[model samples]
Target: MKIFVARLQGTPVFDPAGDQIGRIRDVVVGLRLGHRPNVHGFVVEVQPRRRVFLPITRVRRIEAGAVIFTGRINMRRFEQRTTETLAIGEILDLTVRFDDQPMTVYDVAMEETRPSTWEITSVALYKGRRREPRIVDWGEVSGFDTLQKDQGAAGLIAAFESLRAADMASALHDLPSKRRIEIARALNDTRLADVLEELPPDDQIGILGTLEPERAADVLEEMGPDDAADLLHDLPEEQASELLALMEPGEAAPVRRLLTYPEDSAGGVMTSEPVILPPSATVAEALAHIRQQDLTPSVAAQVYVSRPPTETPTGTYLGVSHFQRLLREPPSTQLGTVLDPSIDPIRPQFTLLQVAYYLANYNLVAAPVVDELGRLVGAVTVDDVLDHMLPEDWRERADYRDE
Candidate 1:
């Protein structure tokens, strides 16, 4: 794997049968799985339409000559088991060098390169303002090289642009509070959400404090209710109230509800965004409503087909459908068929301690909120609880410069 890692992508891959299987497009590893877990397989992109997986077990050898594989599997089976199909556009992004000269891999034809050796088939270059393609011989290249040429040369304009782009993508997840604040100040609301999603509570607070009340409210509205509540709880009471006042009622109301409970509890960290539909709507109507209103309601595996509200004096209390189950069954199939009656909702009164237990025990990313009468109201996301557990200013205070 390290040898291949040293070799740039678009390196040739071969089968034990001496068949020119494909070119190495991507090395798929089980990322989130346990540390040092098995290398799942390699994706060999034969052509635009013929990319396939060469599982780790199939490799007879992986030396300079051929990345010999056992046998071929059907494309459909490969797609079913793999995370994503390798696309030519992705491979085009690769930049490799042959004989120590610069070459781009974009214009390379799939069939041109020898399937058993490291080579370059094509290169993309900007001839003045227009881009030009140059095809080269793979066998002519001495060896493959990695793309790390622009580390120094401090004052170059091109170098600065390259560094700026790299820094944004490789930002430290555990940034200091002050740094977090600076990052928050610089990022727009949407990007802030991406940053905030990964930050701990202390960093979240520090970042939020740097913004004006209106801007802070905007950021909070973008955050889930539970996260917003947790942040609000950390702020000065007056500041918290001011920000709440600045937020929309729909957004503010849920955050306020979450604050009433302890941070660790389900009640404290649940989102109220899951739109509950009444049972009366048809599958087509429900689908239409979801399309029209952008409501992410609970649907059994397909699209959520929920029952309408009951005719009782209080209101209807329909069950949720986990969209996965919804798709497998027929469209006209009744909501009851897909809806799980056993979705034990967490009460708002439950403490954070109890909520954490529920999260740890359950496999759900989020759970539904309901009243004693079984009327659904909100949801509790795992991210909300995680935010609550993290330190509020750890990111900011980490900057102790060894005085």
Candidate 2:
């Protein structure tokens, strides 16, 4: 019997013994080249706030208010895989072309096609506001591969609203490239920039390539200079230069300087916008600056004391004042008075291992990058060093999916 996926959502799921285990969040369906999508499983929100994949094969039966399953269930967190779409999260409310006519999807239903195989069987579409949704066989509409281009990404973005940028990037990686591009287009510049930083180079370039040059430049501006440079480094020299030219002069300057260094060097991996302050600035003022919402924990770990110019490429590097030290000192005290002069800064040309060693040796989360003229150029965080040292595919590691 076909059941509307919308109704299954939030319904409690049970084990063969009738013990409540979780509530259904959505159904995972695998898109086929030219056929109805195969029902892969259900996304179940288990006790204590974990969501895991429950294969359809394990489900004993589906009822109006409950779903029962047999056998053991793995409790590993569910990570969306390639071609697996979330029916409730991604399909419902999507505006797609049905028979060359644009319509909003209201519901989708699935049924067991064989002893253990289930597939989405039909779709409910809105033909008119007052009329009951038009139910049509799923096969009548072209495969989602064809419909993906016409669908808006609002529903998909909503599904990812609660996910961190890294988790969201993982979900985006699992989508078909076309849909991924579509969703990327719909995200605001800052959100897209954060997600882009978490994505691999190939995916970053692909998404960046699809945006209009001006918007792409704006998105790049929102990304960390190191990340922006890294993305541009992978692009053709001409295209990279064009995008740089389109970015605001101040934003482009740091990235341009970063692009000149080898990708693995300390300068290349460092952020030019670390917390910097004049020697005369007070502890109270330094505390307020680091409190900015956008400051990453690594960047906020310490505030560097400098002379005259406080921005990157400042006059003279004084010393560092860690957040802990700031909290312990009197608020009115000058930053220079409390600075830890013993902490050494790394040079721009330090190798990745050298940079890692410097941070490790000092037991510091971030270290300033000093230039030949004794100017503070940038700062490299431990996370930045790890990002360079880890295997290229570290983000895609499958250990999280081990069941």
Candidate 3:
């Protein structure tokens, strides 16, 4: 038999003696891969504000608006296990994107594959009265299991794996602190680092506080130096020092450099990992480096050529080479021949407004930063600039738009 989750809610359950036992409050299921979860049990409201668990094995028949069971139902209150998922409470009425179009989930249809085991097969989506409601296969949707507060931390993490870090962070922000910490614990270092960078300062500090010092240090190492520095700046000085001490010296060094500048300064917002090559490097070598790092569009759009035996914090800044210019030149052509020395580098102490103006005036996606000795230090991307320019509560507003 097939039934919709919405219909199952509020339906009455009858005992073997044909006497009313309770009304169905929720249906519990366990999450699995590829296929829908198997129905585990039913949460039955025995009295006002009181609920009990009725195992699926005890159910004899599921009739219209009612359920018939053969055994005695336990009167003990339902205690949700970590593996259980409550369909009505967690899934139904949630927003999901189907075929890239936003819609609200009105109901979920479950199919009985065997005598008692059932799995969710499809979801009913509704946009508005002007459009006909659509039913889509369960696999064709995203954002269904997001914000599932009661599911186990591992299950919640798996459900959100496809989401971008920004989207995942927004979902995590809406959950209760305990559940949020649980989910944070389940994420790997790289994924956690990305999400942490997208979160607000208070949330970043709160989540980091939950992790062990060693794990927190590893996550900080995985983040962009500027972002890692910003997070550390908000922590107690002693605690921040401890985390830095736990990190690898090489990774920690860049973050330490960023911390020396004021929070609103160019050095504070610039990433220390931009592509830096010697002026003698060939166009092919620069292209290979960009491909190997898999840098983002803004960061990969240009390369800084400096006098170097060492590239990072290069010995001396020569100039910049735009990716477009590199592509136009012969593969073996030296970078020094193509360097754009006319573009001035911003100083570390430059304010946010000055950095923005520099980038805007040059029509560049990123602008290089240099120290007093004229050695290249870092590059500030447009995204980082916008992050500082936006209102403090922008992330909260972004979450609302997703719903």
Question: What TM value does model 3 have?
Answer: 0.65
For each candidate, the alpha-carbon lDDT, in order, equals 0.51, 0.85, 0.81
How many clashing residue pairs appear in each of the predictions shown? 32, 0, 0
Q: Which stretches of candidate 2 lie over 4 Å from their true place?
A: 1-26, 30-39, 43-53, 56-85, 88-93, 96-102, 106-148, 397-403
Candidate 3 Cα deviation (angstroms), residue 46: 40
Q: What is the lDDT of residue 237 in candidate 2?
A: 96
- 231: Cα error in model 2, Å: 0.6
Ranking by lDDT: 2, 3, 1
Model 2 C-alpha lDDT per residue in residues 372-396, reported as the tens digit of each score: 9999999999988998887786665
lDDT of 1 by residue, 1-403 (tens): 2242324245567665677756654444441222222345566655322445777566556766456677764343134234332222122333456556654443332221223322223233222223454545444432223433321111111211222221221232322233334435666685565556555555567667778878988988887675577678878999999999999997787778668766666666666555455555545544444454322232212222233443211143556666555556566766655667766667777766666788678666566666676655566656556556655543333232221
Question: What's each prediction's TM-score?
Answer: 0.49, 0.76, 0.65
Whole-structure CA lDDT of model 2:
0.85
Candidate 3 residue spans exceeding 4 A from truth: 1-151, 398-403
Query: What is candidate 3's local distance difference test score?
Result: 0.81
